[model samples]
Target: MTSTMKPSYAIGVDVGATKIAAAWVELSTGQLGPVLRIPTRRDAPGEEIVADIISLALAIELPDNPDSALLLGVGVAVPELVDLHGTIRSQWNFPLPHLLDRLEAALSVPARAESDVRVAALAEARFGAGRDCDNFVYFSLGSGMSYTLCLNGKPYSGSHGFAIHFASSELAVPAQDRSALVAAIPEDYASGLGMVRLWQERGGFPLAQGIHTLEALAAQGNACAQNVIADAAGMGGRLIAQIVNMLDPEKIILGGGLGCSTGTYRTGLETEIRAHIWEQSCTNIPLVMAGLDENAGVIGAALAAAPPG
Candidate 1:
């Protein structure tokens, strides 16, 4: 559908490494309906992944008139890299590059897709943490690390939509390991998978359990888990501070699974942010939690399809 068509409602779906979440969005008001979540078939082929998204979209009850223009399209927020045309660019996780075409054909509605982090930032800009801020950074520490720079409530995808590839940026931060200084990219230690990998490398927890198990261990007074989490948070904070230093955004909004989780990680990140900020005046910039919770991605994805005027 053309932008002039102005669909009143859209389906927003967030595709993650672990789960797929979706919701119905009212385009005019930026309000989201109840969310539907299901585990992702992480190892499945692109076809299966697309099928899952189709299933989720179809699960939401359509209007009495299925052919009505009111429910106009599907908006997807995916973990993989997406191009300006809504084609998946990276095969790192799934090979469904023609996702938009397949989705549109299957659902008989227009569809749009973008980087999950970017869409989440869009959601926050329109309806969540960044709603009142004109300039801010939306950094997510999920299964992967990436960020979207929002200016005037619109996310800047850069000249080629490759701007926010923070995980592979080669920007290293220093940390102490066994009395020796070591450094690695933020993706190696700060992301959700990175934290789990760090735990496995340290040989403290069972291989099957991931970050949540580590959080549990930390809460139970396990020193190793606590240390690993603290170290990871430090790495994340240092990296985020670099963004703040460069952009000087009005605020930094944190989101994603690891980002929004309740634990010492948040406190640890805040502490490190205060410690590493180069400019004292910028140190007080509010490091606020994402206001939309898990629904941010879906709501934002929907908004992507049916942008608010």
Candidate 2:
């Protein structure tokens, strides 16, 4: 579908497999209100999730005056494959394509949706970490993992929109006695869930706990905890550095569970990433923690619907 130009209060919605978050911004004041979250009825079929978000907008009652001659449009972010025209080709966790027409009908405005991580690069580059540089790399390691390269104001979606997920060869390290508990190519080792798993495998817990424990240990400088973190970052950095070397982003921003944390291993990731770079100057290239955390995607979605200069 061709994107029509419109003047409206941009409504940003970051729709994930498990959760849906919406935000409203009054453009003139530049004041962004608090984000609203909706529990994604993942079990429900189709349009239900999308409908929930539109309902959320009406409920939040942003702009206050619905009759204020302001055209209402939405920028939706999904965690899947999206074409330039906002066509979703394939999706893994969340598939709410059934609500496309209904959403536009209910909002009575133009709506655009793209991959969450991809639009996140746009959002952060425009408003957060990437604000200072024209070139940079972003890796958002949520439940799933994604990499986006932003140059100028646009995200480099590559030919298939999954460019930076390049596979890595196992970096040959000297043989050491690792327990069978640790998998070779640790798939469940880098995400939040994985971190919890790592903690459990190390014989360290009652096993059922919240994120604060993860944050607390990393903050406290636990060596075993830090090792698990370093392992993930070491693996992530190798993949990220390859993208960084190719794109030559001024900064490489890390978000999601492990990336957003402050730990000895987190610092070690920067050192490990610098080690892989051919040009050692990348050592100082700045691996930054995500400033806005998870909210970046929602804010970016709002920006997408806002008027462009």
Candidate 3:
């Protein structure tokens, strides 16, 4: 749609490994309207996923009278490395360019796509904790871990559109076998999976309760759970320190399931980060939780699809 004809209502879709969330966003207020979520059919073909996205977008309530409102476009955030041309480059292969094309054709409107975490960063920069900061690092710690650097309100995707792979960073060197160092990636010690693995390794009874159970146990002062969380905090702190030292960002915003922990867990994380921060000047850089929480991806996608002023 032309800039003058651009609608206030746009659709934002956040596609994750397990689920997809789609919402209608009001561009003028940076507010999200109705949100709908469905299980991501990973086993299905790319065409099916594209169809699902378009169907969800169409399900939202919009003014039937074109004079009152319009459907501007759709923006999608996918959990895979996406190039500038909106092509997926990672192993969880999806034909993103083709998907966007299909979405545009099906919806009769423009469509844009971006990396999921990058889109989250965009949301934060525009409407969340990073709103006041010009440069910051956004770390997402959930079932998996990823980060995006936002400079001057734009995500800094590297030359190949893959800048930092936080999960794959080696946090420690294996003293016994140098060759096995690759197995000690930071995510193994810092992510939700890391917490579960650490708990099991400590002889804690394997509960099928997942990260929530572990966090609950830790809150109740379970020694084993506390230890697991501590290790994760230490590792996460080190990672944050490295990012600060390398980028000197104005702020560090944490998001996702594990990153937004409260009470002792949050304290532990902040303490570890403070302990590892290098320069005294860099020590005061704010570490905050994502203001938009789960909505960051969808809100960001909508903003991305909005016509520039």
| lDDT of each candidate versus the true structure | 0.83, 0.69, 0.81
Model 1 alpha-carbon drift over 4 Å, by segment = 1-7, 63-69, 171-183, 207-209
Residue-pair clashes per prediction, in order, are: 0, 1, 0
| Models ranked on lDDT | 1, 3, 2
| Best candidate according to lDDT | 1
lDDT per residue, candidate 3, 98-212, as tens digits? Answer: 7787888877889888888888998898889998988999998776788999998888889888874776756556667565654477877787777788788889888676878
Cα lDDT of model 2 by residue, 1-309, tens digit: 997543356777888756788777654433466788877887886666666877876555565656663655777887777776677777566677655566678777778777787777777777778888878888877555677888886788877665535322234344466533433443456555566677778977743443456556766876777677777667766766777777777888887655676655467667778888878776678778766678777777776666477
Candidate 1 lDDT by residue in tens digits, 1-309: 655654488999999888999878887777777788999887888788888888888898644454554886899998877888777788766666467887888778899988898998988998899989899999878788889999998999988786677665565334645565554576878888888888878886574668878888889998888988998888888878888888899999989887898887888988887788899999999888889977888988988886655
Model 2 shows how many backbone clashes?
1
RMSD, every candidate, angstroms: 3.9, 5.3, 3.5
Stretch of 10 with least lDDT, candidate 3: 88-97
TM-score (all chains, Cα) for each model: 0.90, 0.79, 0.86
Question: For model 3, which pairs clash?
Answer: none
Cα shift from native, residue 42, model 3 (Å)? 4.4
Angstrom error at residue 301, model 2: 1.1
